[model samples]
Target: MRIRSDGLAARSFDAETVVLDLEKSQYLTLNETGSLLYELLRQERTMDELVDAVVAEYNVDRVIAMRDVEAFVGSLREHGLLTGSDVLA
Candidate 1:
């Protein structure tokens, strides 16, 4: 799977919270954990890497992290914020 970083630029609202702003659109709010995941995605980490990172960083099981990451990616696609040539292939 492909991760899109074009729409997001990292910014800190406070010491604890991180926000992702979509291109010319409103900001997407993320908690500390979500922010960490988002930053990883910015580096174009593969699906497996993201799952591993999430599982390592959070106290969640591998299975749950995989499912949650898939769902989060799907949501990003649905929002028109994510685009990739491979997406249609």
Candidate 2:
């Protein structure tokens, strides 16, 4: 599945990410790793693709990377930060 950052305003610093959901008037703060992941997913990315990138970049185990990426996406979805393929922006 692809995740698109539609309708959200995001800013990334060296160590953190600040995402603003203008529609909901809610925001999220993410650490260095989360910022990188979100930057990667700004376009369309598959689960494996995301995990692979993280593993390669951070030298983490594939299992751990996959789990972490999934959890991050889950939280974004929960907070309405991600726009799923089937959802309208």
Best by lDDT: 2
Error of 1 at 52 (Å): 0.1
- In candidate 1, residue 33 scores what lDDT? 63
Give each model's whole-structure lDDT.
Answer: 0.64, 0.78
| Candidate 1 lDDT tens digits, 1-89 | 44465666657565334445556666566666666666666555566777788899887998899888777777656655554532311
lDDT of candidate model 1 versus the reference: 0.64
Can you give the lDDT of residue 25 in candidate 2? 91
Candidate 1 versus truth, CA RMSD in Å, comes to 3.8
Residue range with the least summed lDDT across 10 consecutive positions in model 2: 80-89
TM-score of each: 0.68, 0.84
Which window of ten consecutive residues has the lowest lDDT sum in model 1? 80-89
